[model samples]
Target: MEKYIDIIKNSYSGYWNYLKNEIFFQNHWDNYFYGLIIISLLVWGLEILFPWRKNQSIFRKDFWLDTFYMFFNFFLLNLIILIALSNTAAEFLNDILSSVGLSLQSLQIFDVDNLPNWLGLFVFFIVSDFVQWNTHRLLHRVPFLWNFHKVHHSVKEMGFAAHLRYHWMEPVVYKSLLYLPIAIIGNYDAKDVAIVYFFTITIGHLNHANLGWDYGLFKYIVNNPKMHIWHHAKALPKHVRFGVNYGLTLSIWDYIFKTNYIPHNGKDIELGFSGDETFPKDFIKQELYPILSKNKDFD
Candidate 1:
C-alpha cells in the first residue's frame, strides 16, 4: 500500500517535469508551424470572402520562380548561414552597434539588463520593422537601388505569390544590410533571427494578399493587403503611389513619413510599367540579366 502510493507520486512528478520542459519548452517549431497554418488559412479565407481582384490569378511562370527561390533559401542559403556566419558574425555585429545609440541594449532604463527574453524579442520585432520600412523607402528614392527594386515592381499583378517575386540581388543586399543593424544592436541569437525571418515571410504574404478584411485597431500597427496593393501600383507614376506602404509590420513609419497611400477606388489599379518596349518573360532574364538592355530601350 505504502509502496504503491510512493510509485504514484514519483510518476506524477515525472509527468509534470516532462510537461513543463519538454512539452512546453520544446514545442517551438511545432507551435510555429501551427500558427503559420492558422494565419495562412485566415488569409486564404479572406481571399475568398473579399478578394480585391479575382481576375488576376497566380501566374504560372511567377509561381515556379517563387517556388525555386523559396526552396533555395530553405535548403541552401540557410545552410550557409548556419555553417559560416551564424556564430561570430552575430557577436561582432552586436559589439560594434552596442556603442552607438542605434541599438537598445539590455532592457534597463539606462542600460536595463533585467528584461526577459520574451520582452526583448517583442522589442526587436518593432525596431526591425521600422528599419525595413525606412530602408525600403530609401531604395525607392535612390536611383541606383531603384534599378534593382524595379524588378520587383515589374510585376503587373498581386497575389500571395507575387510577394515572393523579388530580384534575388535585392534580398542578398537588403537582408545583409538589415541584419547588420539588428545583429549589432538587438542581441539576437539564431533562434530570434529565425523568428524574424518567418515573421517577415508571413507578413509579406499578407502584404500582397487580396484580402479586404480590415482590423481598425491593427491598421496602425500593421499594414494590410489593401495598403500594400497600392504600393505595387504601376500606373501611379514614379515615387507617388508605390512609394508608400513600405511598412512590413507597422504603418507608423509610413504615416510619419508621408509614404502612406490610401486607395480611393474599390478596384485593382493597373500595375507594372507597360511602357517598356520589351519585357522579360523568363525568370532567368529578369533575375539574371535585368541590365542586358538599356532601360530606355525597354519602352
Candidate 2:
C-alpha cells in the first residue's frame, strides 16, 4: 500500500513538473496544459457539431472510463514511465555506454538539428509516423502484445479520450524502441519536438473522433476519420492481408503496403473487438485485464 501511494504521488508530481516548466519559457502559455485544453475543447466541439453516430449519447458507455484513462495516461502511467522505466533505463544505458567509451553525440548518424526547421520536423514526423505505424501493427499482430493493446480496442464508443486510452506498458515498448532510431538522428531542438507533437496530438485525436468523411483529395496521403473508423471495424475488412491501415498520420505507408481499405462510407461500422463481451467494463479491471488473461490470441 505504501508503494501504491508513492506511485500515485509520483504521478501528480510528474504531471505538475511538466506543467510548471512554462515558468521558464517566455510566453504565458503553458505548452502541455494549453495544448491539452485547446485540443480537447476543439475535438469535443467538433464531435458535438457533427457526430457520425447522432444517436450515441455524449456520456456513452465507458465515457467517464475513457476520461479516467486520459488523465491516468497523462499522469500516473506517464509518471511510471518516467520514474520506474525511462529514467532508470537512461541511467543504466548511459553507464554501459560510458563504460564502453561511447556517447550518443559521438555516435550521431546525421546532423538532424542542423537541417531547416521545416525539413527537420518533416523527417522526424515521417520517421516517427512509420515507427508508430509499425508499432500499431505489432500491437495487433503479436499475440501477447495484443493482449495489452486490447485495452484501446475495447472501446465501444469512439471519442477524443479514446486517443490517449492505452495499456500502461505501451509507452515502455514504444518509447524504448523509439529511443534507438531517434538517438541516432540526434538533433532535436525544443521547437522541433513541439512541432512534431502539435500534429500528433491534434491529428491523432481527430482521427479517432466520431466524425466522418474521407479527406477527399488528401485521403491517400493523410489519414482521415473515415479511413481510421474502419480500422476499428468489428470484423477485419475483406482482403486486408495483415492488419490493414496501421498508419498513424500518413496513409501512404498503408497504400504502399496494400493494406489500405476505405469503403465509400463508414455508416454501418460497429466499434470494438468482435464478440468482446467478456472484456472488463471498468477502468481498474481493464488495466489488470490484460495481465490476468494469458491467452495468446486476442480472443
Candidate 3:
C-alpha cells in the first residue's frame, strides 16, 4: 500500500512539474477568461440574423438581470477554485490523471511538443460535457441538492444570460461530483480543462440563445439554439424538457439517456416556470426562500 501511494506521489510530482514549465500555458492565462467574449459575440451575432423568439429583445431588463447572475456566479466560482483547489489539491488531481493514462500536462491547448491541437480540443469538450449532463441530472433528482438547482429553474426566460443564471452552490457541488469519476478515468490537464470551460461557457450561451440560426453539420453534434431553447420551456408536460440537451459540446449523452428533445416537430414551447406566483422573483430572495419554503408541488 505504501508503495502504491509512493507511485501516486511520484506521478503527481511529474505532472505538476510539467505544468510549471509549460510555456504556452503560462503565456495564455488570459484565454480562460476570453471564453466569455467569444460567447457574447455568438449571441449578439445570432440575435441580429435569426432570433428564435421573435418578440424577444436581447437588451431588455430581463437580460441584464440574468447577466448579473452569470457574472456573480462566474466570479464566485473562480474565487473558490483559486483559494480552494489551486495548489496542493491540483497536484493531487494531476497525480490521479496520470494514473488513468491522462495527464494534466498533456492537455494544453498549445504545446511545444507535436500533439495536435484540434484533437485535444475535441476530446476535452466531449468528455467534460458528459460530466456536466450527468451531474445536472443528479442535481434535479437529488432532493437535498435540488435546493441550489432551483435557482436555475426559477428563471422565466430564455437568453444568453439565462445560461449563466445559476445558483452559486450548484456549480460548486455539481462540478465537484462530476469531475471525480473523470479524474479517475481521463487525462485532462489544466490548460485542456480551461479550454473545455471556455467552450462550455460559449456553447452554454448557444444553448440558451433565443436566436434561431442553424449551423448545419455542427448542429447535430452541438446543441443549437432551438434545441436548448426548448429545454427552458415554461409549459407543462413540456417543462420536463429541462432534462435534455445537457451537453455544452455534444448531444450524445442526451440521446443515450433518452432525454434528447428536438423542437422541429412542433414549436409551442414557452419559457419559464408555469406557476409564476409560486416562483420567486428577486434573485436573492429566490436563493434564501427556497431553503425555507417546502416545494410540495415538486412532488
Candidate 4:
C-alpha cells in the first residue's frame, strides 16, 4: 500500500514537472509540445498551398474540435494519465517478476545495447510500426475497440490536426500493447530516437491533411496522404469488411499483408461511418458514448 502511494505521489510530481517543461519550452528541441506545433504549422501551410479538396475550407468543419483533441490526447491524457498508470503497472510487474527470480533483462530477445544506435533505432522503429499496424487492425475488427476508434473516423473534413483526433483510450490500448515489445529491445533514451518519432508525426499529419501525395515510387515504403485517404472511406470494399491501410507509419506492412487498397485517387471519397451522423458531436459526449451507449453495432 505504501509502495502504491509512493508511486502515485511520484506520478503527480513527474506530471507537474513535465507540464512545466512543456509550457516553459525547456528542452525545446526534444519537446513534443513544440514538435507538434511546428509540424502542424508546416503541414497546415502545405494544405493551404496544395489542397487536394479545393472546396474544403481553411477553417474546416470541426477543426477546432480536432485541435483540442490533439493537445488532449498528446499531452493531457498521455502525460498525466498514461504516464502515471504505465509507471505504476511497470513497477508492479517488476515486483512480481523479482519475486519469481526473473527480470526484463532476462526476457530480451536480443541485446539492443550492443547494436549501433542507428541500427537499434531502425529495428525499434520497424517493430513498433508493425505492432501499431496490428493494433490498428484490431481496433477496426473488434466491435468494442471500434467504439473508441470511432472518435477518429468521425472526421468529416480531414486536416493536419485531424491526425491526433482520437479517443483518449487509444493511447491506453496502444501503449499497453507496445510496452512489452519495446521493453524487450532494452532501454534507450527517447531523445536518441526523436527523429523517428518526429518523422512518424509528420507522416501522420500529412496522411490526414487535405494534401494529395503518394511519395510516388516510395508509395509502398511510406504511408502518404493519397493512400491513407482511402483508409477513411465511408464505404468499405466489397471483399474487405473490417478495414484497409491499417499502417500507422509505414505502408510496407499493408503491402506485405495484402491489405493495401487504393482503387482510385480517393481525393473526393466520402469519410465517416454509416451512422456517424448520430455519433456524439460534443467532445465530452463523444468520450463517454463508447462506454455508456448501448450501440454495439459499430460494424
Candidate 5:
C-alpha cells in the first residue's frame, strides 16, 4: 500500500524523470516488455501463416481485449512487480539469509557466478519457471485463489495475446513467491534474467498459440500448444482428476505430477470452463467479475 503511494508520488512529483527512468528502457523490465511485443508479432505471424485453427481470423473474438491485457500486463502490472517485489524481496530474503549466516554474495560455494553463462541461464529458467508452474496449478486447484485466476481461463479463442492474458493480481501472487527463493539462491544476474525471459516469454506465446507445429519428441520436454490447449478444456475429460498440464515452459513437471493430458484430438479442443457462457467480454467488467461473483467456487 505504501509502495503504491510512493510510486504515485514519484510519478506525479517528478513526471519526466519517472517517464524516462521508471517507465521506459531504464527500468528493469522495459527490455523484456519490448521483447514481449516482438515475440507477440512473431507468434501472430506464425499463427497466420501456419495456423492450427485455420478458419480463425487474426482479429478473432475478444482480440482487442486480449491485446489490452498484453499491453496492460506488460507495462503497468509488470511495473508493480519491479516496485513491489524488489525491495520487499531484498528485505525479506536478507533477514532469512542473515539468520543462516549466509548471504547472496557468500553463496559462492555453489559457484553460480563462475558457471558457464549458458548453464547459469538454464538453472535460472528451470527454477523460476518451476515456481510459475506450481503457482499456476494452485490457481486452478485452490477454490479461493481461482477467483483471481479465472480471467485467464475465460478465453475461448486462444492465440498469442492469450499468453499474456491473466488477472492483474497474478504477478503479486506468483512473482512474490518467485522473488524470495531466487533472492535466497542469489544466483540471478542480468544475463540469466535476459536468457530466461528470452525463452520463457517467447515459448509462452507458443504454448498459447493457435498453431499445429508440435515438436514430436520435444513436446514431452517442452510444453506445446496441443497439450496446453487441453488445460483450457471446457470440461475435464473422464479419468482426469483436475485441471491438467500445469507447465509454464517444461512439460516434465506435469509428467512428474501425473497431471499431463494430451488427447488424440487435443488440437480441436474448445476452451473455457463449462457452463460459463456468462463470463464478461469487456476488460473492466472481467476485472470486476471475480469481485462480484455470487458463486465463486472453483470446486
Candidate 6:
C-alpha cells in the first residue's frame, strides 16, 4: 500500500517537473514540446511553400481543432494520465515479477549495453518501428481498437498538426505494446536515441502534410505524404478490408508484408471512413463515441 502510494506520488511529481521543464524550455535541445513545435512549423512552412492542393486554405478546415489535439494528445493527456498510469503499471508488474523471484533483466533477450552505442540505437529504432507497424495494423483490424483509431481517420484536411491529432487512448495502446520489446533490448537511455524520435516525428508530420513527397527512389523505404494519404483514403481497394500502408516511420514493413498499395499519386484523395460524416466533430464526443456508441461498422 505504501509502495503504491509512493509510486503515485513519484509519478505526479515527475510529471509536474517534466511539464515545468517543457513549458519553460529548460534543456530546450531535448524538449519534446519544442521539438513538436519546430517540426510542425517546419512542415507547415513546406506546405505553405509547396502545397500539393493549391485550392486548400492555409487555415484549413479543423486546423485549430487539430492544433489543439496536437498539444492535448502530446502533452496534456500523456503527461497527466498515460505516463502516471504507465509508471504505476510498470511498478505493479515489477512487484509481481519480484514475488516470483524474477526481474526484467532476467527476461531480456539481449543486453544492448554490450553493443556499441550506435549499433544499439539502430537496433532499438528498427525493433520499435516494427512493433509500431504491427500495432498500427491491429488498430485497423480490431473493431474495439479501430473505434479509438477513428479519431485519427476523422481528419478530412491533412496538415502537419494532423499528424499528432489522435485519440489519447492510442498512446496507451502503443506504449502498452512497446514496453516488452523495448525491455527485451536491455538497458539503454532513450535520450541516446532522441535523434530517432525527432526523425520519426519529422517524417510523421510530412506524411500528413499537404506536400506530395514520395522520397523518389526511397519511397519504398520511408513513409511519405504520397504513400500515407492512401492509408486514409475513403475508398479501400476491393480486396483490402482492414487498412493499407500500416507503416509508422518505415514503409519497408508494408512493402515486405505485401500491404503496400499506392494506386495513384493520391495527392487529392478523398479522406475519412464511410460513416465519418456522422462521426462526432467535437473532440469530447469523438473521445466518448467509441465507448458510448453502439455503431460498430468501422472499416
Report how far off residue 93 is in candidate 6 (Å).
1.4
lDDT of 2 by residue, 1-299 (tens): 46555655665676557646643543644376566658878998898999988987777677788878877786556555555566556656766789999987777788678888788888778888888888888888788888888888887778878888889878778888787677778758865587678678777788888788577898898888888887877777545533567878888999998888876577667777754778888878888987788753543
User: Candidate 1 has which clashing residue pairs, if any?
Assistant: 93-184, 106-112, 107-112, 108-112, 276-298, 276-299, 277-298, 277-299
What are the per-model C-alpha RMSD values against the true structure? 11.7, 4.1, 7.3, 1.3, 3.7, 1.4
Best-to-worst lDDT order? 6, 4, 5, 2, 3, 1
Cα lDDT, model 1, residue 147? 65
Q: Find the 10 residues in a row with the least total lDDT in model 3.
A: 79-88
lDDT value, candidate 1, whole model: 0.60
Clashing pairs in 5: none
List where candidate 1 sits over 4 angstroms from the true fold: 1-50, 58-61, 73-114, 192-195, 237-242, 274-277, 295-299
Worst 10 residues of 5 by lDDT: 11-20
Tens digit of per-residue lDDT, candidate 3, span 45-84:
7765776667766674467778778766665444434324
What TM-score, to 2 decimals, does candidate 1 have? 0.69
TM-score for candidate 2, please give it.
0.87
For model 5 the local lDDT of residue 177 reads 80
Per-residue lDDT over 123-167 for candidate 5, one digit per residue giving the tens place of the 0 to 100 score: 667778789899988887777677777789898898989988888
lDDT of 4 by residue, 175-264 (tens): 889988988888766787788889999999999999999988999999999999888999986688688999998999999999999998
Better of 1 and 2 by lDDT: 2
For model 4, the superposed segments whose C-alpha errors exceed 4 Å read: 25-27
Per-candidate TM vs. native? 0.69, 0.87, 0.72, 0.96, 0.85, 0.96
lDDT of each: 0.60, 0.76, 0.63, 0.89, 0.76, 0.89
Task: Please give the lDDT score for candidate 4.
Answer: 0.89
